[model samples]
Target: MLENLKKEFLQPLEEFTPIPFWFWNDYLTEEELDRQMLAFKEKGVDGFVIHPRLGLPEEIGYLTDTYFHYVRYAVKRASQLHMKVVLYDEAMYPSGSCHGQVVRENPAFASRGLRMSARESAEEGELLIAAVKREGKTWYFWEGPSGGTIRGVHYGEDDGEAGAPASADLMNPEAVALFLQLTHERYYQELKEYFGNTIIGIFTDEPNILGRCSKEGMIAWSGNFLEDFYRQGGNEQDLYLLFADTDSSEGRRAGERYKRAVYERMSRAYYRQIADWCAAHGVAMTGHPEKSTDIGYLQHFTIPCQDIVWRYVAPEEEKAITGEHSTMGKCSSDSARHRGKRRNGNECFGCCGAPEDPYRFTMEDMKWYLDWLFVRGVNMIFPHAFYYSLRDRRKEERPPEVGMHSSFWEDYHIASDYIKRMCGLLTDSVNQAKAAVLCRSEKLSWEIAKPLFENQIEFNYLEEELLPSCRIENGCVLIRQQRYPVVITDGKDTPETRDFLRRLEESGGTVLVWNAALTAQKIREAVKPAETFLPPARDLRCTCLRKEGTEFLFLVNEGENSVTTNLRLEDGHICQIWDAWNGTIKQLELPVQEMKLSLGQRESLILVTDRGE
Candidate 1:
């Protein structure tokens, strides 16, 4: 079994290839498209996302017949090459506007938001959000919609802001339906034959409620948001609390209710609608939401996804381990695991270099980002881009293009093969985690996560929404074949979540409230990990997985410095070191109770052992 697994891991399937976003950013000719496709295929990358980006001349308008002609040619060529294609469902990012066609056709569908003012001035056709008197001052909240600004995709002179295009109201189901009619339906019409075969899925980039460039202090709203909120048991008085930052219990609860309502409405209006369309058409809906911790919306995705862009995480940065974005890798992966999905994806390495030195992106930095995602259980990778043309200003749209125009394009196969092997290994394996950290749909406990990573504790983030459906079995929380003997919490739980935790505790499960008093030693006592480190390497991260009858321990040095430690395992197990980078395996001597392990900065290693009977 080990030998067979080794053989399989060495030569991964094409499905595991890094499907980079092929930015169609210039006057694309069939000859140039075929040449770039051939180059990618030669470099071991068997798939690409046809991302329509900036720099295309007005002659080739978005979603025009000419655009479809080129897209059809690329899809046909991909089929001939036996390569997969994922259609990006937008001209440029923040999808759902159909490149402003949705709002252009119906100006009423433009993005809307709620604004509060002390003076009441009723404008014609303006929708009133709320009316509340706080501290004897009457506050009038009304819709303040804004969009349809024709700022093309380029870096703004002021603070390098990438101006957003006209965005439709994603909170409105009618607007979303129009978007699908213009974008997704057109793709299905053009490439109906390749729905589930050559063309695997459609990518919907982040679609927010109000979208980018919305007015400050305005909450995302739609024409019928108040009606839906009322239908969902929301009070009109609570609407005022959303505009204020008061810490009163009533205000806090009201804020949570409003945000929850917004998330639910957007999920039903936008994500669910798109997901159903894809499912009916035999394609998968794959994309991330606006926020990283928006796991509530991710449940609707066939291929749950999140993105790491603009240096949200880096090699030696604390952001990599202790930020809201850091949880995104696990956010998608855990959502997939709970939903019984095979793969989760991340769109990574976009604008990851320093702003002062955008071209300073290195192969080592790429490797670190890859390991960060793979170790967290993400199996599919969408490399930020492979630009078709880097002519003129197109090169600066999103800096540090890691594809055909990169400094390492000659040896691109090296990175491609590494991606394939790591993705292949993580795809079908069962994550062997004995603990779960409870989190809300929009909130993750980074305070708890930081300590857990430092202590080498392997766990998954379990959303509170999923707790009721989970079965409590013999002092363990079981759901979708994942069992957790211990559940950790950051102590900021909602009433419903607290009730669920109480039930779990009553069922013989260990509930650890994350606080300053709760140390790593206490966590070790509760989880009692299968493997232990001699001196507890703080910056070393590990994920344990099982495939066939073998166990694999993937370890990464997330810190800038080197780490040396002795790993101790059970006496009956046999260990081997599998090098994913070079596809090599080294057997260990018998009686391997304890072995010394050393890893350099941003380096990773895999320890394979037998599942002893």
Candidate 2:
């Protein structure tokens, strides 16, 4: 049953329902809120990842006593109607602890603001400011109203400011740690008291490990690793001084590790910490990582750990997210939009799922990835976003609308259905594995890796061409559920590579490491690739197995075009076993060692080599 279901897993819920976000805030009056909620509610959304939007300026800042009132009111309304409401802190995307106008939006100070673009801000001029001085410190803010006159931004704050542009500073461990504490406890005191009466949980946006979040021009730049980094590493201070990513060897190594460590640490600090706190006070936490790449970094970092992972772009040297070390028994891989392609929208940009239009990679692309991730255990479908419409034009604003351009009613219908389909597959995916992907420590595996791990579905990365045939394990990587010979993979000869190769060598299983990583010397030097394989026919698909009373052939059709399928078995060349691919059954009269069928692109088909008949 699990095997059969795994085949069609992602197919069901592979559409965009609602991205991990929403709209409706202080700007929208109580009446407006009612109308928006009612409109969306009728549209059949799973829930809303609510926030006090940047557009709702007067609504947030420090989560004071009064802030809770509006929140409570909103929560009550949302809850009364049984809406899934996720509270995204006081501010909008920047989170509440950022450095924008809340402090000083002056062009000079703007550079100091977190995430603020120098060119954009200067053009727009100074923004409304409202800084708070707590214990001899000037904390800034500009939670005024609206996305407020800015298209693209550049030069975020990392200069004379608190590790910022217009976003929160996460490097200052204390600030980060404290911010987590307050959101669940201090900030939402009244709400926490009211609990189930209002507000479900909080949505913490890309809260990466930051430096200084104080809105003031002065802040200690030392980060979690600054001291030690400065000690063993030369010019540690210079590392922190970079306004943008510099490719210097010093900068690269330092910055990479900084980004990696920050991602991991913050996940633990915020996801786990804040999640636990929210749970205690009756709130749930969910959002993508600030460092959208680094999958494993995120997996081990956050508290509750966002069941949903996001895929975005960075330098070519980065994969968004890479697992901590490497753990391989077996796992899955997923894909998102084309990484390193283009950047248009916000969090929901192209990073959302594929373009809902022509559907970029195609059905085969979907099957290709599904099968891979099914092995890894990632079952949740938090697509990049749902555009507010179906008639989506190119390069629009924040709300990407899941690639739609139709009105709410029409778009909602399509989105809700899409969400349901994806949710259904992912729901079942949370617990099983259909097959496995091989990880080669050949170390040079990225050639094969890029095709498989370059993009993501949830937090896990899997090539789209591969998703249709796989099942998500628990929310990460791809899985075949049933192993297949010629397991295609990027070639890297790490310990991971050795094991898969060893399984086939020492005992008899099969894994195809692409590019073979071994040069003539390496292949000849190793003399037989240092592993074992179950001996059988050395043609067509590689491995055939008979364990206990079960017998099967792990077939592989690596050809780009269609190839004939074949299976030689004990029972008078069993006409047909069971076609796992499309769940069809076939019977051939004569002794045909090969079954003729057109193989889909990048397709892997495993035929039952034997049967009881």
Candidate 3:
């Protein structure tokens, strides 16, 4: 068993690496199904996500007897081929509505939101109005007035202008319960025999509260929000203030607190409930949250994930402008590392090429994306999709099939092997970070995070929820195996964080109060910089992880030109390079304290050692 485990660890495509064949049930046929799974196995793919998506014919019928029959065939074939099966919870994505089937049965269960629109009233009369909140701004409306009330309710609808199927209210427990019964429970009932064995877990897509929320002015609402807010120590009158544009400090504070309460209630109603359900059913819940940069909410996922969309640009450009979309991988990875999760996932390679230049995603672009993910500690790969049929319209649905039909299909295993090799090293390894920055808010945290990323200062974003588990020990904030000698507090300090800083200071740890321009002088003052790794020039990213007394240092070149770098270590040290290009681990003997290395454009390298080796 030990030898077998070791052998599996060395070559983990089947069990450890999860580039699951996304079996889009478009034109379901037993022969075609078997062929796809076997084809995936040939490409070193070892798992499949049974996704029933658009273009699936009406005759097959989603979640029907025919659907189950196809599902059984796929799962059974995977079992025979020694591959894993992960169930996609919904027929179409942005889950929770069960493809609008859930809300269609009961319109009351459909998602709801508060909308604020203004129109001129012909009658000149004084009217009492209630204020409503929309995207952090307040809008006012007359109470029960006719013709043109500024504040009116809007039912949940698709992002498109045309009326479509309504999204289920995730904040409503009843609506979520119905969703589970109609979708999740149905999967378990049909696939119970393989739940924990061949069937590994279920992937729940982002079940956002308001699907494709309006950009103009909209706020989410639930049937039980008012009472729940009051019960949770929120003022009933202050709720309206949350929707109002107030300049007073007290009013602004009240609005922030009330909005936070609403968010907490939604999380409890949706994520906590889904997590509990998955735990009970002997499966892991793996999926991204609606807003991936909301780090605190990531704790609810069993295998925290984020979706990487659009094009694969340089990391530096992504950091400068992309905001939440780009930094999602780091957010999920930090959340997972803090909670000791072994695997973090990403739904990547979607729309890599622009719509006009479809099927133009080169293998090099995929490599760059993979490097970005791995550097941030994302180990699991959900390669966006794999088509069950490239026939007719199914060919056009989420086109540029990166799987069996792509131009590089014959050489898919080359990329597959590299991903698995890197992921195998990342999994079960302890993160080696010496500092953490308080993730006060997304904007401020990213502001401070920019300098940290550019300088290659490895750290994690410490959320307030992780504070209780952290403590100052020997002049450092200690949590499990991770330690931070310096903790940077950015923006307005919260009372909780202020208290934490005081405790940390009293315990002889250092804290850097963030200024507008977070200069290197401030960072240098907080903690003396080390010389473990340095490049001739900047724009290189590196991260460290330790497992079983061996430390792994991963480095990537983020620039266009080849560069030479020196890895500083103890004199006469021995280091082994995990060369992805050659697929070999070659030993390195260092004569001096710094070892020089030359990396090509868009290239990366990993070094393994145990102090002197």
Candidate 4:
């Protein structure tokens, strides 16, 4: 089995070839489309997501007769070329709105937001009375009194900003249902023949409530928010405290609870329902949410994915509030592993640098980015964009076309092949992490995760939803066949969370908490202090995976400088370095316990060993 695995890993695995985001805007001829598809095939790309984007001429309108005609031709050509086609579910996105068509028809389905303002007299009869505590004085709202009122209002075409139209109300089921019917179901109806075959999945972009906000005080709201809030056991009186400045603990808890309920409803309406639809239609739902690093939001995805390009921390930004580039990728991959999903993807290389004056990323930068994600267990890649036309003004649509127009277009196969080989080894293997790090929140997890990532300590981020299903025994917590020896959590603990911790402790698993003290006796990691190491260079990140009783350790250097480090293995095991690039396996030239290894800049190594030698 080990020998076969090694051979397979070394071979050119076609399925590992990435799917680039093919932007179909201009009216493309059949010949040109066929030529591009063949070009991708010859360049070692196995698939593409047909993304309808801006700059499309009015004649070739979105979701019209011409559009569906082009779709059929594209899918048919893809079938002939032996490449998969993923359906991008919107024209331009934050998805769910069907490019404002949902609201254009049904004006009531427009996205909504909540605002709290000081009003001398509430002219609108619908406004709810709100309370304000200012300078130790409590003020109550009235029709002509000196307090504030909370109003639920609609966001117009640009979501009250300067851009495209507002998104559909993701928290509202009717709006999301209309979006699916217009976008997803339309594709399904037209491409039924290719459903279970070449049409691999539907890619939905970041669908969120409360459109991008400029002010800190903005809150998400829906038409039925008040009714839903009360129905879901939320306190009506505490709604005012959410928007007000209050340092009280009860107020904070109330606000957190309210936001969580909103998130739950949004997740249900958008993610769960879409997932169920995909399952019934014999296809996979493969896309991402707005807050991609929050692993809980990825639970409903069939293939589980995240976008790592525009928003993730860059290499130069070391002290960034977010972790390194691989942070979001790891979150998606970890969630997939825990949930028994075989594949996880990333929408990579989209709007990489600063929004203003975005830099055109070089081939070298692309390699490092690809390696960062692949090392962290991401198996599938969506290379942000491939423009339909770089002609005229269309060239500046998203800029930085890493496709045919780029300098490295002719040599893209080298990068693609390399990624394919790495992915082949990474997938179909069980992750051998010893710890399950719980993400209390995406921000907190980002701060806490770096220590474990940088020190070659392998762990998976356990989401809030997965806590109940886990079982602990013999100093290990078992979730789906993987055993986590330690469980680390960040932030405040609840009675429910505390109970879970106590149960883990009682079952003999080590529990570690950050910042807060729990009733359960465990290790408290207040801050991620500097880690002390034997050889001293802690830039190499590692992951352990198992296949047929043989264990493998994948170590990758996240830094630009090379470092020689010492690796220690279990007492009874022998380590053999599987040189992935060269496709050769050789034993470490030392005792079975410890070995010194040299790693180059951005280098990765796969070490294989028997379970007990």
Candidate 5:
């Protein structure tokens, strides 16, 4: 399994091959495009994502005139050199998605961005459950106006008169039908034949739909959501009906539940819509977040439903926050007063406040992002972008208008090398989701206190004292309603743990306490006589070092004393030592038959064990 995993990890990665650089808005000159690819090819990049400049004289149609020529030429050229190619699908940003910007730029574009206006009257909300006929097909529209403040996003020179207070009026069935239809025509329909497998799937870049702000909310969706919600025993006959008033405690709970359910339905609609379309077309789809807060959703429902790994702003944010003397942007606090707070640097930095240092793609950033995303269930990435050339540009190529206006071209090689190395470890790690804590449907801490589940982040590891009785899975200490015998490594066993362990053992569960805390009486007290969460009546003991199912258990010396001790999980259970992280197993060379897995102050060792090895 390990070997197969390694092979799987390297195979897809060996083929991933991102196209090096691009010259986005540098519209004219096919000659220039060729020149860039040729230069990138010389630098050893095996693939790329190229697109035409928007609104160029030639970009009037789907792509610039020689678009296909460029694509076929690049593909043919790359193919000759054994490389892969990807076309930055037509258009860019909020409107480029579905030719939404094709119509005159909405005066509302700069005004509301994607906010909604006004709470829907109950009459309007309830109508969301009604089936409306559009083009002879009855479909569901949005149930109500969404609530949000559209005062933020900028669109060139602000002619902001606040526009009309608007919302994502999916409640208007006509709009819902058109959205679904447009999805089919724009991305699906014949995308399979158009790009075939060469284009692994549709990259649904930024799919923000709110046109204005609403105190109620303004998300867009099709008819399937409301009906499905009702079918699942929800009474949202009209979306406009305020299921819960968030103004008061009780109302807030109800509103939260309503919003959560609706968001789930809406999010799933998107996942399924793209997923189903992708499966049908023989490809997989990928998407990024509208904001950084959506990473949890991506872990549980969003990315899992899609085949590819997702990207988040954490990497950049973490970098900016910890980089040298730099501090996080003032707006990072999520405070109410942080509005209108730009970093005042004309470097044209985006969300993370400053651009990534192009010539120096930091390894520290790569390691943090890789480990973080891995634990979050993302096994793949397209990264921010790969430009065609680091060429100078001033005009818009198309919708996104995303130019390679950075040091990316110079840092190209290092970034690609880092990406390739990381992919090699990640691709095969997809199947490593074998063991996980089943978040209880009741208390629901897992829903909100999600960081605990993804506690592998370097600074976020468990504090053996606070959450000692935690179950080891995917580098996290799993906590639940009852006490567990599983050597919870993070904190001292809580008060309820003793009884839980006793019951678990009574039920044939084996409770193994971590050797790291054997010195503490509370640690032993936490593991009751009877086991609860593990096998019953099974022998359990502490091992200075042991192995259990693909994980290594090393009881580190929390105190600064070097002590040699006998090691064993159970009598005569002769443990084996292997280092899978580097593929150097069976290196346990010790005369006492007890090899020391050393740890200094705040040090740790992973004693991995796999069954049937």
Candidate 6:
């Protein structure tokens, strides 16, 4: 198994190549496209997502014959280059608008939201969604009958910036179906021959039901949301409670119910429908949703993904280890793991540089992000983008192009080779984790995760909803092909989850509730660390995986300081170090129980071992 791994590592397949989003932000010509693609090929990039961006010429027109002609040419060129293509579903995103065509063609399909207004001062055209009397005052919630209620005021006209493309109502299945007709179906009609072949999948950028620029207090809503909410056992009165600013238990419960209903409806109406379409067409539904913690919607993606753009995470920063976006890497990877999917992706490195100097993105910054994702079990790489043109204001649209025109373009193959090699190793291996951290669809317990990471206690985020289907065995929770000896939570447990934990604890499995006093010592006592480090290196992160009886341990120094530690390996294990950057394997002759290890700041190492030395 070790020999096979070494061979595969040395010659990682093209499928593992970093697939960048190729921004077609200009009046593209076939000759220029061919030249740029050849340049990418030379740098070990074998795949690209053809992303149409802000500067695309109006004459070409999104989803028009002129656009199809260019898309077809690119797909054909990729095929000739023995490369792969991922079709970007939107002309610009958040994806569902199809470049504003959906809302423009059917104004009723425009994004909607609920707003609270005084009964006497309500606008003339306002359709009352619901009415509730509280404190001797009658509150009117208006935005048509189906609009969902939430607390906030200040509805913006479009999804993103003021002039950004209008977004479609994702909670409405009819609108989503129309979006597919205008986008996905149109692509299929033009490129049917490339589906599942040269064209591997469709990339749906973050889709939000309420336009990003919607009124400040507006909650995502659609025509059928009320009916769906009712069908899901939600009370009509609770809708009013959702808009209440009270910290009462009823208000909290109402908010939770409303959010869950919205998530479920949108997941069914949008993501699942797209997944089904991709399945039938022999392709994959890739890309992410609006929020990083939207794990529930990830189940519908064939190559479940999350984005790490906009400086959400940076090297040596607290943001890298805590917060909601920090959980994104595991959000996609763990979802794919539990679902039996072999690969998961991250659309990384967009605007990750310092805000003051956005163009200062460097090779070091790029490698840091790659290591961060790879160590988290992510196997697919979608480098934020390679630009088709940087002419005029195109370069300013999303500053700091990471490919083709970057300072490191001449030496890019080094990063490309590193990406392919790491992705190759992570792809088919089974993650060896002993603990599961319980999380919700839209929430993750990053506080619990922080101590675990610092302690080298590898864990996967287990969605609380999946608890009932998991099997509790002899001191272990079994789900699909993975097993966890202990489960931890943030103390925010539902009745069902509480009952499940009770059953698990009764079966000799460990269960922990996260709190202010929870420490690394406490976690180490409850869960066995995947790899033990002498002197306890807090900045050293480790991910262990098993591939055909051999353990592959990827260790990353995510901090600024160098880490010197001794690894305690099991007896009878034969150890070897694989340098991913240079594709070199070296045998290490060490004591059966211990091996010396040293990692520089921001450096990573891979240790492959098998029993019976």
- What's the TM-score of each model vs. the native? 0.96, 0.51, 0.88, 0.88, 0.52, 0.95
Quote the positional error of residue 23 for candidate 1 in Å. 0.8
lDDT of 6 by residue, 1-613 (tens): 6678788888877879999999888887999999999999999999999988777777777788988889999999999999999998886777787877787798777778777655645553456667777768887777632221111111221234354556677888898999999888999999999998999999988887776556666666777577777766667677777777548888887788788889888888899989999999999999999899999899999999999988888864677898888999999999998888889999998888766798789888887888889999999999977888888877876667999999999999989889999998998888889999998888887778888888899999999888888999998999988899889888788899998899889999999888878777888877766457898888888998888778878999888789999988644453688889878888877625567789997689888766453
- RMSD values for the candidates in order, in angstroms, are 2.1, 12.7, 5.3, 5.3, 13.0, 3.4
lDDT of 3 by residue, 1-613 (tens): 3233234345654555556537464667899888878888888888877777666766776688988898888887777888888788776667787767767787777666544444423223223234555456554533211111110011122245243345777788888888889988998988898888888888887666666532234466666565666665656456555555556776777666656766687678887888899999998888877665766667777888887766633444554224556577778788888887878889887766544676666677677778888887888888876777677756665555788877788988877787787777778777777678777323226666666666667777777667888877877888766788888876477788788888888888888877877685568556554434464346667787776666667888766677686777533353567766446666666424467878787688877655554
lDDT of each: 0.85, 0.36, 0.69, 0.70, 0.34, 0.83
**TM-score winner between candidates 2 and 3:** 3
Best by lDDT: 1
Candidate 5 residue-pair clash tally: 60
Which candidate, 2 or 4, has the higher lDDT? 4
Off by over 4 Å in 5: 1-13, 18-23, 39-44, 49-81, 85-90, 95-97, 101-194, 212-244, 264-269, 289-368, 374-377, 389-414, 430-613
Tens-place lDDT per residue, model 1, 1-613, is: 7677898678877889999999888898999999999999999999999988778776788888999999999999999999999999887868888877888898888888888888789554467667888778889988857532333333331122544467888888999999999999999999999999999999988886776665677778888778776765668677777777558888887777788788888988999999999999998899899888988889899999999998888765688788898899999999999988889999999999865698778888899899989989999999998988889988887878999889989988989988998998898788989999998889887778888888888899999899878998888999997999999988888798888778888989899988789998899898998888878898889998887777898999888899999888743464788888887888877737678889998789998876565
Better of 5 and 6 by lDDT: 6
Cα deviation of 357 in candidate 4 (Å)? 7.1
- Candidate 4 stretches greater than 4 Å from native: 120-163, 212-217, 231-233, 319-326, 353-359, 441-444, 515-533, 572-575, 581-593
Error of 4 at 555 (Å): 1.3
Q: Give the Cα error of residue 383 in candidate 5, in Å.
A: 2.2
Q: What is the per-residue lDDT of model 2 for residues 1-613, given as tens digits with 9 covering 90 to 100?
A: 4344334432333222343455332233467556666666666554555544322334343264555655566567766766655566634344434334322322221212222222222223334233334335443432111221111111222234232334333434454455555555554655554454445445555542222233332221223333333444434233333323457765666654444443444455445665566666765454444432333322222221222222232111242223421211012122211111110111232232243533232333323333332223233334334332222222233333332232334544444543344334333222211113332111112333332332110112233233334432332333432322224444534464455345544443334444656332332222231112222211122223333333333333332344443333324343344333443444456544444443454444433333443
